[model samples]
Target: MQLNPEKDTELSQKVNRETARLPWSELMRHFASGNVVWIADELDLVDVAVRIAHDDKASVGQWMAAGQIAKVSDAQARDWLETDTSLWACVVSPFILVQQQKIRH
Candidate 1:
């Protein structure tokens, strides 16, 4: 089977858009339940803003204090991320654990 380049690009863009539009509340729940994951690439940096209320610094700050989400440094991500190594962030924990996307259909 052959893949259409245009379709692939369109789908990729769509996924990214979806990620950025994720609601902050949902992200908080992900942190609370340990169901969060992300890629460690430059694009991952943009991925952080995908959370719903990411635009509201106040709300984000509150979530950070409550341990719902967190932003880690590059030095910190270097510890485990060796493959596509890039940006690093976290969901409630001090460590960053990015998972590769392999479930997309």
Candidate 2:
């Protein structure tokens, strides 16, 4: 059954149920081509980071601090849609995690 985000609780510290998920393969393709992906997935920021980058969850936080990854709002994602770096993804939450490299080693 499809998850009803409307009936769920907030995803995490900064994310909420308003988030959504996108297919991963297409996401990877877009990222591989050097495009920015605005992720609206409702996930632990760490997990999302880990999923998208070589760094583990802990390292993901560091990446965030280092500006390797970023979190954006739905509005920002929407605004970005028209930009060159406008690729997007959402796995379950409202957090938008982005990195400038490959997720796998």
Over 1-105, each residue of candidate 2 has an lDDT whose tens digit, in order, gives 233344332233223232334434335444444454443333344346334433245655665566545544455444444453423333332233443222322
**Cα RMSD (angstroms) for every candidate in the order listed:** 14.2, 12.3
Any runs in candidate 1 off by more than 4 Å, and if so which? 21-26, 43-105
For all candidates in order, the CA lDDT equals 0.39, 0.40
Each candidate structure's TM-score, on Cα atoms with residue i matched to residue i, is 0.30, 0.31
12-44 in candidate 1: lDDT tens per residue? 555444432333333443445544544334223
Predicted structure 1: lDDT: 0.39
Candidate 2's TM-score: 0.31
Clashing pairs in 2: 21-90, 22-90, 41-90, 41-91, 41-93, 42-92, 42-93
Candidate 1 clashing pairs, residues 3+ apart or interchain: 20-50, 22-52, 23-52, 24-52
Query: Where does candidate 1 have its weakest 10-residue lDDT segment?
Result: 95-104
Winning candidate number (TM-score): 2
